[model samples]
Target: MTTPFSSLEDYIALPRVESLALSPDGRKAVLTVATLSTDRTSFDRALWEIEADGEGVPRRLTRSAKGESGAAFTGSGDVLFVSGRADASAAEAPDAPQLWLLPSRGGEARCLTRLAGGVSSIAATALDGETVVISADLLPSSRSIEEDAAARKRRTDASITAVFHESYPVRYWDHDLGPGVPHLLALETPGGDELPEVRDSVETGRSADESRGVYPSHLTSPRDLTPTPRRSADTAGQALTPDGRTLIASLRVAEKRSGRFVLVAIDVASGERTSLFDEPGVHVESPVISRDGRRLAFLRAPFHTADAPADQEIWVADIDGGDARRIATDWDRWPSSLVFDRDGTNIIATADHDGRGPIFRLPLDGSAPEQLTTDDFAYTHVAVDASSGDLVALRSSWTRPPHPVRVRADGEVFLLATPAGAPAPLGSITEVATTADDGARVRGWLLLPDGASAETPAPLLLWIHGGPLNSWNAWSWRWNPQLALAKGYAVLLPDPALSTGYGLDFIARGWNAWGAAPYTDLLAITDEAVRRDDIDEDRTAAMGGSFGGYMANWVAGHTDRFRAIVSHASLWALDQFIGTTDNSEFWQTVFTPRGLTENSPHHFVRDIVTPLLVVHGDRDYRVPVGESLRLWSELAEHHADDDGTTPHRFLLFPDENHWVLKPQHAVVWYETVFAFLDQHVHDRAWSRPAQLG
Candidate 1:
């Protein structure tokens, strides 16, 4: 049933919908209709609307917002979005991202905001359509559009060589040289006089110097939005006032420790701010509000984020900022994803306190919370239509791939992702059990290739996600599991030790242990996959990005299980990475009892034996490109030893950063990766490194 192709470019693309949102009336579904770039490895997000019944070829609403996301329809049907609203370069000045207004029926998008500095997120209210609250790169107090992030880091005496990527994610990256210090500077009066600390607006100051070494690469040398020690972090989406008069979200402000966070409510009309929730020495994440707008929910942990709260409990607050409280009196595991019902009678969120993801609901009037869906795997996402209160969620297991289903409160089910006779229904998803090297039962998902059996073992790809702190849920999306599976290779995302929701001890166990037991979980999963009749162990390949990229690099150095490997925005050199990453202090010291400078990939590059493919973004300040070159150079030097070491190739994208957002570059990168796999895994051939246009 698969398309037989001579090269990766001819492969059939994976069909999927992402970021699904419902129209106010619940008659239409608005989602991003995404397809693999013709280049065969990248993806593009276009606005698409489909019937609520999950029928028809979705109507494309807008094609112009290339990198835009988080789309929604106002109560009146006008389209709203958060996108590349401005040139990040203009961030220091008072400009806005290009906020556009698109007609619900269809047409060219109209600009709403000049959108100068980066506008990261936006949302409309259920009560009134025209009102919106957004989060953006506040104007930095500085002015210097000519220096690179590296230069800025250099100017600040930060280690420039190991910083990953060029520009760190605006909110994700903080100015940090070490504990008790911030690498970014606020526009201050230098000298005996202290500059008044301005916390309400983004801060920036102009400097013509191009030598502020090791700043973010994605951002051109320009002004930066100095984080208010109180409003430094933000939420994925905003919740509106019952009357659409305000928007509530979580923001990260500066802290004396490694990471600090604050959740606030902003009046849409007056721009007045209400500090709803604040925790010093703790991190706040994913703040969401209920339908009545009287209650708010979010996740909180330690500032440096090494440990969870005494419990990562779900907390709620009065919209007026009078009385705030905790919803779950006892939370054993971390909580994820929050959503409120149409009438504000119930609050829904995903958590793994039960060992696996089980959707649960808490009553607003103080009723006990109840688990909604019971599954063996994890639920990565949740969707609720406020108009009708219809709910949909995705749950995946180790052996089974992710399946999206419309679920009812009474336990009824209707499959959503499956179309009648759609190539391969998600039904075949399966799981297997493996024991980590330490003998703990670890679960894994298995998706076999089409038209495959024991006699036809297919190539396998060990795909790992970043955020050793993040969990890989069983869900379907365009970027992973789906993309690789469509390309004829089996993909694996094992929930390793450092992974969240397994309880604090399990999560903290992997700390500083770096290349130790956490690796055992991944390898154990691979060992089980190889034991399957349909897997081609000899033709295996491994790939990952960010912290996962660190694992990929570490795996290659520790063993040669795969034929080829790709490391994206990787932290390859521990020492350099600790000193260079935008989160140097956190990753270096806070992430573990020991520091990352002592726990990096550079320590074992000399022992690497696999044929490697190194990929990085010049703008990635999170996991800098230098890590790639360090490993690549070591491989090159090994070959020059007359030792005839295995060959290595490097792929660098100049204008991109941590995540590949550009259409053409994504295609090229995807194609290269698949071609690399085809040579060593499926096609069973090798060739000189050829650049793809």
Candidate 2:
């Protein structure tokens, strides 16, 4: 007999494949697989290679205690990756990730560059593998690599641990910014024993206490490509031209009220820059240069506001920023992961549609977009082999984790890698649709557990997705529906108003009115789902995180339909959340005082009748821990008169961030959730999770 899949232990231990990169010749492909570390406190990533033909078994490429990731192929077929491994010839900064190169034919990997702040991302040209560009952190006062190292040593010796900020945002979603700013560097590999020239773009301004050091001779000299002091470019989405002559990047431009992003093109040889595209109040990002170096494609969206909702549109322009046109202007969905087809006549991209993320083919000739894939699976990191028209992507679904797959011209998909273990049997997933009170069409995914039928119906669990802007189109390890299915519950995944894949009007329906259209649309879809014979409507629960958590809190106040509610890192008082969130300026532009007062869940806390389970992480900067604390305190005050029958609970993780990442914490999260449901929904005695004791 086959072993059954375990929810917390087995699911958290599964090897997750995140991204895929195809070789220039299209013969080899590299996949970045992240697995649980030995301590199970974090994930370790490594590069794995497989044949694009789907014949040979997958083989591990690089291994180290620190692990390797960000794999890319050079024009000469060599594999270049990033790691933090310590080497005797290099400076001993084990925390800093550096570049490493592995020979295409086969050889031991060698370290390339050693920077003080470490490398964040890299891009290489297909014309020559040796020509490369990297994004690294550098102190604003340091001009060269040696100066940066000296400044770092001085700071460490003084034991100073404070960051000074002059901007609106000091911290992002999880971590603090500053101490060093992001800078782009251009370098070429040394040929034969000849050392390349390294130029320091700015003068070194170190204090008298700073140490001095010499640059390594094995690496080529790097030139500072981004010379601006306070303006940092997004290197993760940066793209390089085929000839390696130009670099395209999205730069963050600071403004008085809110910031805007603009696309800029840099000359690799002359160190000159030109603004390719810049709109007054809009943000542009995700630039992809065509293989021929003739055209550039990017996504543009307005800055968040009540008047302009965040709906992204794809735009095409000449390499010199001329003849720009917005393609698929009439299309409803916003496209992502944009890439040029083998021919420059079309673009291949992924977008949220219905309840899934499917790839779409958009023609440059001004025609409507055509959906390529029909299944419920979501695709990401799409890559097309220029030599052949073959396409490859990382596909994932509600039941399946992300895996590398090949898409044929006829829309057939073939799995490229077979994971080691199998998950427990999953229920059947079907698409359900309904009309809201305003006659708007909404859709959702209904997961029916195994052996569920009309005679023995399964309890319903409404799982709301975060993003408020993001739809439930992809598989998420942190909030997998399989755990709920294994507990004999039917899961309902709904995409209400403000969810992408639908048009801008759908998003506008909930703009600054979060508690209005989105709530009713969710309710309408859940109403349709519970009507199914296999779902038990009388016994139901609701749960969500982030924006979904906000909705769960709203559900508790608005209706007593659910027996229990689980809200994770949710927004309690909108006024307080908008002022304290990491990106408060961005939210300030989107919400008004009236909207905050009208939509806040904390205002209606006195109406809550169902039991609630609040979960939060102290490290979550996006949705701070104070939101949950205030919620718990208010709920406690309201329930002081009642007996001990309600059984409301709170779960807190000190080390975690917005999401529960550690393996042990994830197990506890699920256990506590199910236990709370069993007590209120099933009318059973409250049993605390054994691990909590």
Give the alpha-carbon lDDT of every model: 0.59, 0.81
> What TM-score, over all chains together, does every model reach?
0.74, 0.94
Overall local distance difference test of candidate 2:
0.81
Candidate 2 lDDT, tens digit per residue, 231-264? 4654436677887778887878878634788898
For candidate 1, the C-alpha RMSD (Å) to the true structure equals: 10.3
Candidate 2's clash total is 1
User: What is the clash count for each candidate, in the order shown?
Assistant: 72, 1
**In model 2, which residue pairs have backbone atoms overlapping below 3 Å?**
198-221
